[model samples]
Target chain A: MKAIHHIEKQTGKAFKLKKGAFLTVIDPMGQQVSDMVLFNSHDVNEKLSSGKSLDFEESILLTKGHFLWSNRSNKMVKIIEDTNGRNDFLLAPCSKETFEIMYNYKGYHPSCLENLYTNLKPFGLSMDDIPTAFNIFMNVQFDQKGKLSVLPPTSKGGDYIKFEAQMDLLVALTACSAEDSNGGRFKPIHYIIEE
Target chain B: MKAIHHIEKQTGKAFKLKKGAFLTVIDPMGQQVSDMVLFNSHDVNEKLSSGKSLDFEESILLTKGHFLWSNRSNKMVKIIEDTNGRNDFLLAPCSKETFEIMYNYKGYHPSCLENLYTNLKPFGLSMDDIPTAFNIFMNVQFDQKGKLSVLPPTSKGGDYIKFEAQMDLLVALTACSAEDSNGGRFKPIHYIIEE
Candidate 1:
């Protein structure tokens, strides 16, 4: 329920966007993301809430990008941009395979995503059916042929898109696998979610 | 080797720093971080590969101001500004106390630091000695009496205090726990690790 203004310091101009407007993501980098996925819930069905642990059925239902939910408000939060790549963050899913690949698998933290699953599985969630999601910052671009591949990000400080969430949604995001050397060293990204 | 220049885009100025700099961060805003915690890793002695997991030591070390660390190249990375009021970060460690205070124990994430310790105990780590970290970007400040308290950040994009990592240290960082309500949520941030 607060208002955020997008100001470009270079020109000292600001864009006063509509509060609770739809989400709009813009990819300025001009590239494609590999295996980038989008998932939505059916707001009309109203299958999710803060207390409800997400399930395979609910996750699968979200495949069409239409199993809509709401935030605290009835307004919408847009998936404005996939600035960098289009991959669904490469379901690497933090496995021992990942540990072995990254750190010789000799000594893993034992608490990667796989460990998360082993712990959370008791609550009725399944990673197998984890809905593919749009990688927010990673970029995946398309060629003229629409061939999917990873690309660099077109987003910067002043560059941003807008969107509206039709309903209150519980969003799950995996920052990214700490594999590649992009994203300028996993520095913090400040997200300005507004009303 | 690559050099990361913290560029102040508006003024066209840059702080050209080498890779692996010793960065001392401060949280101006001592706000209750609902999401992630930030910190200033004054010095992490464990060895680190280019991309690897940081072994957070059990004891918390408060990196004093003006402390210095040298890299493999023997380059100096000084703590130019070890302590500032939370320019744009919160200074809080991740713990059950932090969670209880911030979220009011309303909800519990199984993976919280408290839980992280339970799982890590088997690995010879305990909750008392898990990790001590500063909440970067959330804002914390020092009063005239030198009292540490949380505040809002005063940092703009590209306005970073640079330090050369005295050595290749495994650093694990995530975006702050703030939203677009403030100046966050748009672009997470661009922290380049120039090697």
Candidate 2:
């Protein structure tokens, strides 16, 4: 199958998917991470909720057969297939604040939050509107004490996860920019949307 | 010292604290939970960020001497004391969807999200502005596989946690409406703000 679209390393893309369509996010290069956020096309106020999904799914690691629920209790998408099973919903997408505070960087940096808002701006979503994202191919672990740590993804080249839209949706996806998230190397992300 | 105020069962309150003021949240009844959210008084855009605080503090279990950071990478408050040490920042405040989807309750229900937004409206905040809250005395445990569970709070009656505001702040506190979070019972939350 041919990929209809691809996001370059450290960048993002935004688009709309009709109800019943399928979206496949591909890690074209090994260990790259993609951050994805979804909003109901008919009502932007009803967006993806990490809390709801976690509560309903009863698991922190989401994968094939799990449904991503919205803040309004609606199912936005259902994972139909997942070759790379580890995804993170606990952390918000990396931002400029992430670099400044965590990485100790002093200057402007490309971040998932910036990429998401910029790409979604044409769809009228602002910076504050961004929610905790479904981080694909991202590895996050927690200790018994509930302390979280970001680790390099385990996905290999050509690995992908596919989701079937449960409703008409506006989607934003990022080729994550955080060095820690991508195992210290940048790589492109590929995706295909099919009816 | 007397409690400045109290939040009734399943209710919420909003207040402001000057910089350097200490705010204490008390679990007057053991096993009850309170959710807290903070905003910068001078700039609402710079509000509490779980990711930042978790990153800077290097722990998910925030306790005494830890500082809560904002989205702007500025300190908002420092945990001065913690008698009930387990606080949760991983979950968003329980909302109407939480009831409908998780509990399978069909009718209208009280929720932390509604209480927070209603109480905070006077301060120019809306439902969308609410972020993931800091759940005081909420016992959330995760396993080695990352599966999370909400357990009854380990706090005893009269246990309290105190924070010193690093900057002037607008705060919203809730006597959490979620049944599981509070061990299947509703109870009040007490708080005091001191110079």
Candidate 3:
């Protein structure tokens, strides 16, 4: 695997990947989360749909061998490898409001929503350019009664997940800014794209 | 209120409004759901955030006297009048996958996600344009244990909800296409923009 890009903590970045390329995200600090969004390279209209992907995989939790499906198009990417299986698809990306409402903290806190909009602007995209994301390494769990909670990631440092692009894709990722429910600090993540 | 535009049943439409204009959705045939999304008129990037709105209103159910807040810009719209108080902000707009997965029916299905995208295209907006919607007139209840279930709308025929725009807004609405969980039929909704 060749390292193509390195995303800093509490920031976002975007890249284009050709079909068959492998994209990997590494949690360098163990407990951080990566909020990832995918778009069709040829047509920005289609995007990775967590709802569709979950339905396609017929599972509540994403795992190796499951396909990530776009809302308009079918399969867009496939998860072929995973070192930490604690990713979450149920939660929306964190925003300024999330910080203000959930934690009572205020004043320009780092947010995945802002990071995504800022990073995707070079591609001429805005906040209205993507759907909800796949929050990799963020541990969120729901009980049988439907109550949900976010938990500290169970991944260790150096853990990662790899996906194979099934089509030309534009990917955006945010090293999440919010502290874990357990008050774990956010950290940087590294990425690799293999030809 | 003078009618400016009328939306047919199971279809979607978009309109632009200056601050203070009132938008009303009428359940003409009753027991139908209208999935609605709102965006900033000057910048499509900012959108109505159900989470933010819920937090601002400090309630789970949207009713008369509540404000609909935007994710970035804060308050966007206000529910000034509501003939039927039953509404939802927790559930996402239904999609083809929702029907296929929940109903075991596999075929083209009318979805709020597709309808919203199709109607907003003329405005150069797409699926990424908005967040989860305000499901007007859709009755969703949660038990003490947090289990949720969709119920037939409590709205009667000709009942409606009216909102006063707090900002210049771009609004998209879909007369929901999925059957009410209780096997209630979907019906058309009439919309009026009062100057």
Candidate 4:
């Protein structure tokens, strides 16, 4: 497939993808996390639900051959390829308060919530439309005691995950702005949608 | 105010609530849990987010004077009156797999997922639209060690929680089908919407 559209998503930027298309998200700088939220193109109410996806897959890890299920819809997108095999499914998208509560960052910092609202506004969506996202390329592990922590991505430059849109989709992706657990800066993400 | 509509929701039934409306969900038989999901009337992409509500209120319990925030939207519904004062905000609505994995329930048992889908279809919504819900009247508590358990509701017959819509909204509610933590049977719920 050839690229029909390319988006160089900087930290906290967002973009959309259409249906019957393939989107490959690239970690150009490597070890950086990306947050993504998906919704039906025609109906904003029909958005991806990580809880339902986890329940449907019966696993905490989303990998190749797994489908991302929207809360009401049976399938929205499918993971066709995974380079890192370490994407996170457990963490909700980082919000402004997440920075404050989790990292003790004060004042306005970059957040997936703000990025999504800013990007979605052209399509008539706002903060109310932001949903929990699939944190692509994020490494999160839980200990036996159930304590969880985010880790730096294991991906190298040019590493990517490809998703096949099961329906016409409107996806919002954010090159996360939070420091990784290892205190490394978040890097840029690149994506292309091809027919 | 008089009820514009009233529904006698048997176990596993779902219904919708419109905007600018007051919805009173009653634990008619007492100790029964109700699972509720809300969406923006014009856009399914925006659904209620318990995480956002918890963060907005800085509390885990949904009580009178608290506003339920959608993940992106600031507030979607307000708890105008809560008689039981014990509404849960932590548990996702129970699904078939939850029953199977958690309780060893076998075969076609009812589920909040199915109920929400069945009820939402009339509004042109399907499974993808079912976001995580506000599990009203469900008694869930976390122990000091952070172990969570669902306890039987403290509500008696006629106990209810009332909510006022903050936007034009569509709500799907189910009289939950899972057995309570105490192994009690799930009971019916009733609700009325007043303009």
Ten-residue region with minimum lDDT total, candidate 2 chain B? B51-60
lDDT of 2 by residue, B29-124 (tens): 789899999999877877887766776676778898899888666899999899988988877789988888778899889999999999999989
lDDT of 4 at A166: 92
Winner of 1 and 3 under DockQ: 3
Ranking of all predicted structures according to TM-score, beginning with the best and ending with the worst: 2, 3, 4, 1
Judged by lDDT relative to the true structure, which candidate is superior, 2 or 4? 2
Output DockQ, candidate 2: 0.51
Chain B TM-score of candidate 4 stands at 0.90
Q: Write the per-residue lDDT of candidate 1 for residues B49-108, one digit (tens) a residue.
A: 100111111011212232221111122333344332232211223443333434456564
Local accuracy of candidate 3 as per-residue lDDT tens digits, A40-110? 98987778775456544645578688788886536888999999987877566788878887788868898
Model 4 misplaced regions, further than 4 Å: A1-18, A181-183, B1-130, B134-175, B178-195
lDDT value for model 4: 0.72
Give the per-residue lDDT digits (tens) of candidate 3, residues B88-181. Answer: 7766678776787668878898888889989899888866565678889988766533335778888888999999999999999988988863
TM-score of each: 0.28, 0.94, 0.73, 0.62
TM-scores computed on chain B for all candidates: 0.44, 0.98, 0.95, 0.90
lDDT of each: 0.30, 0.88, 0.78, 0.72
Q: How would the candidate models be sorted by DockQ, starting from the highest?
A: 2, 3, 4, 1
Instruction: For all candidates, state DockQ relative to the true structure.
Output: 0.01, 0.51, 0.14, 0.13
Q: Provide the clashing-pair count of each candidate structure.
A: 106, 0, 0, 15
TM-score of 1: 0.28
In model 2, which residue pairs have backbone atoms overlapping below 3 Å? none
What DockQ results for candidate 3? 0.14
